[model samples]
Target: MSRPNLRVNAPLLGARRSGPARLLAAAGLAAAAGLALPGPVAQADTASVRCSVPDLVEAIGRANGTPGADTIRLAPKCTYTLVTADPGSPANGLPAITGDLTIDGNGATITRPASAPAFRILFVAETGDLTLNRTTVSGGRATDCPLFPGEGVCGGGIYNLGRLTVNRSRVVHNSAVTTVDNLFAEGGGIDSDGTAATVNDSEISHNTAAYSGSTPSSAEGGGLANDGPLTLNRSRLTDNTVSVADNTDSFAFGAGHAAFALTTIEHSTISGNRVRAVGGTALAALATGSPLPGQATSLSMTDSTVSGNTTSAPNGVAVGGGLGTNFPVTLTRTRVVDNTATAPGGTARGGGIHIGRTGDLTLKDSTVRHNTAHAPGGTARGGGMSSATGGTVRTDRSHIRKNTAEAPDGGTAQGGGVFNAVGSTTLTRSSITDNRAVEGGGIFKESGTVTLNDTTVRGNRGNNCAPPGSVPGCTG
Candidate 1:
């Protein structure tokens, strides 16, 4: 398919000399300093070339074969659209940057085909030190074209399999669709596998990973998926989704997973993303060779907020709405609140947060509140926090309050504030208050040793007919 002809805008030079007398004064100063000189001191080798989207891509493709260094500059207000499918040839639509190349967008907009092949807009594989500055990549999605089904697999916005640095750029409204055996398709905006990428002062939002029709099911990353060393400084990830059916026969172990990383989220806002599985948000590995095991997903946050996310399914399957961690999940100076998980009865159990077995969770100077779990005449426990077998959770100088569990009568509703099953828990200098459930309104402990020190568990009410349980510091 032929794309519309793109108009390449010319580079805008700085303002020219207005008055002739001023230009003469600048020339006289040069004569006094050295030999003859022309106008104002010509700015040092800061020459900038301007090109539209197609011209920029063409220049990069030409430089890919050259043996020297090349840098392509994009003009401001310029837009490039990807309309054709993969031409079934190497170096076809594949722009290359061999040396240190800087594709300065100059505030340009690069768009992709809206229909399919949402995987990548600019595939930068085998590039050496690529830098994208002040550019915007949008409307890209991952898809397997009938002509080249398995070829276009990876990154929806920009696939960087090399050292990449993106500064002051925006990657939004992209998606990563499903492929063949790859059950985990991530990075709705950008996907980097085994690459070193740093995104600074950027926004990656409103992207999605559509894996609803994949065999064996899969997890979709609404914002980003990184299987490499990725550092996001001063960035925001919000409003993404992964849709999957919530049934034993149809619920094939994939959907609504972390759009960012199976590793870590540091100093960023991972809020307002929706995942359709039991635990919709982030899922980290537990131990190597076990199921999903890796220490790379260790999210260290300071002054960040993870709130206002929602997860929904038909049957009651326990969905960890915010994050699903299989390792030591730690939060410092963070706030996790106002997230919801809705499951009928066999869909979900934990509403806000779900910790897996053999994982350690630590929260300091944080708050987890106002989360809800709707069971509808079934057993649902741990509205705010839920831990599984062999899990260790510790919270210090924090608050866990105002969470609700609407489990029906004669149902097992335990731990409205905190729920621990087959795991060790420690609460110190914290507040667990105003949570409601059928039993263990404040705290629920099942086959796990819980140690509480200098904490207050107050105003939490259980079913009126059920007998009151022990409050913090008030042992019956």
Candidate 2:
């Protein structure tokens, strides 16, 4: 896991096996059987990559040509630059994984040349299984492609439609950009569709997503755009961005987009992620599901810290500088600090959390502080959180302080702390203090039922809220 300070490089979880041991494991097996497997002694042959294979592409072909559950044990500390003559249907480029396979990179780096065609480093086809061990994938660039029926291009670093797991790996400095109108760009580092890509002891950082298209399309998920299930443990996502574009109908999302997916993150850190759209979210787990009673989507974050993230729709509506979800979201033992959601010419809301779907949002033992929602030409509300109709907002043993919601150009600004509009809100054993807004500085109730128990509502900048003995603590 990354340290609280962002300057250090966290190492992998466990030590890697030595090269000598791996090189000799196959030799020992062959000698014990009184049979000789003639190949170079530098790499093991427990799987498919032969010692005589010239390059990575051939090795991939050889491995794919073989049957199920193969492992391509690569030479130690090698760098394979994948290239292709025809990238669309490439004879080169990492072959699409056909079945279950493990690439024992042994600390290798698989990348592409600078002058190569815009291509991703890896693609996991449907029903294929890929496990990357101790490797690095970088320098990928995905341009406008017809992958989304002339509507979008995604997964600059990795496009996965299957199962992908990584152990002790890093995916960095990749990008996905689209210039075609009516098309969108997603997943500067990775885009997973129906792909349960799990990462352990890994880092995905420094990726970018730039899309300048028309309305009704989003340029989102600077680090990862997941349309399925994604889980992370002991990982970091930092320094990623979704650049501003002409998107008006849809908003951009950064860090990770659980737009139509389920995400679980634990012991992880998301920092320094940025987005600039007409009105979008930054560094949030966005759940865009209106399910049928039993098909709800959600995000769960435990023991995580989300800091130094910015989301702005400078000319549109901006919500959720830290998190935006339409379904159930739970934040336990989490800290969301120093984040901003700005809408300079439009509406801005929810500097920390935006609950849109009609579900319950629970925050336990969490801290939401030092966040801001600013609007220069429009209204601003909910420096800490905003819950729409049908959603139930609950906070227990939490602290929400030092937040600001302001409209600089004579626009209305209310709900500096919390905004409960047509919802049910409950605060138990929580602290709300030092929040500043134009009207309600502690909690705002447009039309809702609020219940407070053992909660502290004090030190707010405006005396807009009622005394502690009331539910839905504020009245405008």
Candidate 3:
């Protein structure tokens, strides 16, 4: 959506002035010294190629072979639509990047028409480092990528094996599908494997990754899949989804869209993202992953908002509607609210947050409220949080309130606010209030070490503690 009159930002202007713009600004000074400079004097000389409207596929093909980290400047106010002339050829969409490249959209858009085959708009190879500025990558569907034919499709918009940088741009409405049933799909918008991706001041929204058939399907990172490091700064990820088939042992991750590696998010908003599976053995939504058996996967958020993200499998156990991790998660000044996990045929746990087996969760100055977990046929546990065995949860100066855990089939509902099972739970100056459940409305402590120092439990619908003696100031 950053079209003509995109309003040059200070960072973009500053980048130009410092890098290649020096060739012009300093030209006057060089001319005074009677020195003639040929071109950009950067480590790898910069090349700028202007794109033609309907021939962007060829333009991208040419840019892929550029000598160095060059720039491709598109024509102002143009939307390049790519179509396939040959349906059988694997070389259909834009060519894969073979070298370092930077695309300056200049208010243009890159998209493939619906008539084209299911091809991604981009492929950043291992040797290709891409920096996209002021553009949009939309409506790409990677159904069959010839490079790795047997593997399930990935990176509907872009597959990055090298470094990727997106600034002042948008990646939306893309999809990654399994050409053949039962395969895995990942990163409907972008997939970064063993690399570093930095997306700032942009929007990645409305993307999906899915599969069908009686066989199993696995989906990760609906808007993005990161098996490497990923950073989102001042960006927004909204309304993305991953739909996996039922009756499989599957994991649907990152409705707001992130995963598997160290992820750092600052001043961003991830809302209205979802993962809905038909019926799987176990389904973890929002974000799902575990570190090496002994190692830990980390998700760190600062001053961000994670709200309205959901996890639901029609006939499977649903966990972590807002977020889930098998390792450790650190949230500072973040808001987690209004997330839900409802299992029509199975049980639901942790409508807001779920700490997997062998996981650790921490929240500092954060708020988790107004979440719900429902089990229509089975048991519902932990409306706000559920920590499994060997898992620990810690909250410092945070609030967990007004969450609900329900089991409509006359099952069991425990811990509308929090549940600790064979895990250590600690609260320092936090409040758990107004939670509703069948047993231990405020907290269900079943064989865990619970220590509440300067914490409050009041106005819960049922008992405050499961055993009535595990927590101080709580009586059944």
Candidate 4:
């Protein structure tokens, strides 16, 4: 009898053994009989194929089967717009790019809908390193995805669950909104969950997190939210906002902290972000809930700039303006300027920066200036900076000046330059001048131990009702 011909499906490997198995055996016999294979077998080290959006999308979907054989290179000046038909299922939204794909924009922009759910764009879940150079990922909405709440409604621009290297790219105007009550919203622009994300000379700005129904709790990073070791080298985090109640509540919201577990910011700028709480311009006034139960958040800035940020409370009450709960913030070769926390009744303190509640803050080779705490009825202290209630602050080789606190109703105000309260403070080789406090003038100490070495306190004015024997330095 004549041998029967078998047909084999190469792509259907590992499913089941049937006629295809005999076909593979026949193919092996044919190969041994000096017959070449029909399909072109891809070899290793093949050049990346330049592909369009559709081609690239298809390649990503087939990445699992193809493995290391596929590489899609995007065209220069081409823009890819991703659209999904189903609102609930974002998994069916866009193609998953795996297998060493290089989708270069060539200085082009990728535009997506700002109202679409998260993961509607490129999903980099593969192990291959994805690089976006000189590209712009903008205008995506991360909201109300029932399919994948955690991963879907995050990183509206590009959801990177793998290693992402973004160079000179821009991630802007992205937002994550919560539909269900009590669920936290996070990462307006990009959400890196324990991924190795290196952002070099990039800009993450103008992102937000908006929650729904009855003062929903939300944290908008306004840029990038990372739960990993995030390194921002020559980057800018600007104009982020977190809305919550004022009072000690807002400090715990974890807005900026959402972007990183451990953040190392060098030669960068974190400015113009708003934290709405009870006390005006005070992060301590918000009801955001702290990262640690009794401890504040951690922000370490070196050779960077944090300026033009605003923290505001409701109408009444006075709390931390610049920083919320203190939380071990160390600043070296940095600048914190032009920040304000305004409270009614003139009881606001720490207009520029607020150190509170066993929080430890240290400033070395830095400058804090042009911050204000405006109060009318009660006392307003620390025009430039404030420390309160078991908070410790130490400054070395720094300058604190040009801060103002206006308390006109005869309430005692202190520390136009520096305010130390209920904690230990040490200042060395620092100058505190041009600060006006109604009571202590230059340096205000209340229930704390202060040691000043090689420091100058001058040109500060005490108000009319200065405490009996209290000048700028020695108060009674």
**Candidate with the greatest TM-score versus the true structure:** 3
Clashing pairs in 2: 278-313, 450-472
Q: Write the per-residue lDDT of candidate 3 for residues 1-476, one digit (tens) a residue.
A: 11111113111000000111212333454456476445554454344445554355555566664555666777775777767532323433566766777888877788877777678887776566889999899888876533335556778888876678999999999998763555667788987763578999999999988765455546667788776678989999899988766665454566667576678889998889888765652333446455543333588989988788888876777777887766578989998899887787677888888877756789999988998888876778899887745588999999999999998876788889998888888999999999889988998888778788899988888877776787766665
Candidate 4, residue 120: Cα displacement in angstroms equals 5.6
Better of 1 and 3 by lDDT: 3
Error of 3 at 397 (Å): 0.8
| Residue lDDT tens for model 2, 100-157 | 7789878888777778877777877665788899888887777533234345677878
- Error in Å for residue 391 of model 1: 1.2
TM-score of 4: 0.74
**Model 3 alpha-carbon drift over 4 Å, by segment:** 1-55, 85-92, 144-149, 281-285, 293-296
lDDT of candidates 1 onward, in order: 0.57, 0.69, 0.73, 0.57
Compared with the true structure, what per-residue lDDT tens digits does model 1 show for residues 170-274? Answer: 888877766444243455677665346788888887877655443333444567655455676777777765544323221211122232233444566767777
- Model 2 spans with C-alpha error above 4 angstroms: 1-54, 85-88, 143-149, 279-293, 388-390, 464-476
Model 1 residue 313 lDDT? 56
Total clashing pairs for each candidate: 27, 2, 2, 32
What is the TM-score of each predicted model, taking all chains together?
Answer: 0.77, 0.83, 0.85, 0.74
Model 4 Cα displacement at 5 (Å)? 68
lDDT of 1 at 453: 87
Q: For model 1, what is the error of residue 58's alpha carbon versus the real structure, in angstroms, after optimal superposition?
A: 2.0
Task: State the lDDT of candidate 4 residue by residue for 65-180, as single tens digits.
Answer: 46344434455666666554223335424554444545455666666664544443445562445666777776666653222344224555565555677788787776665555
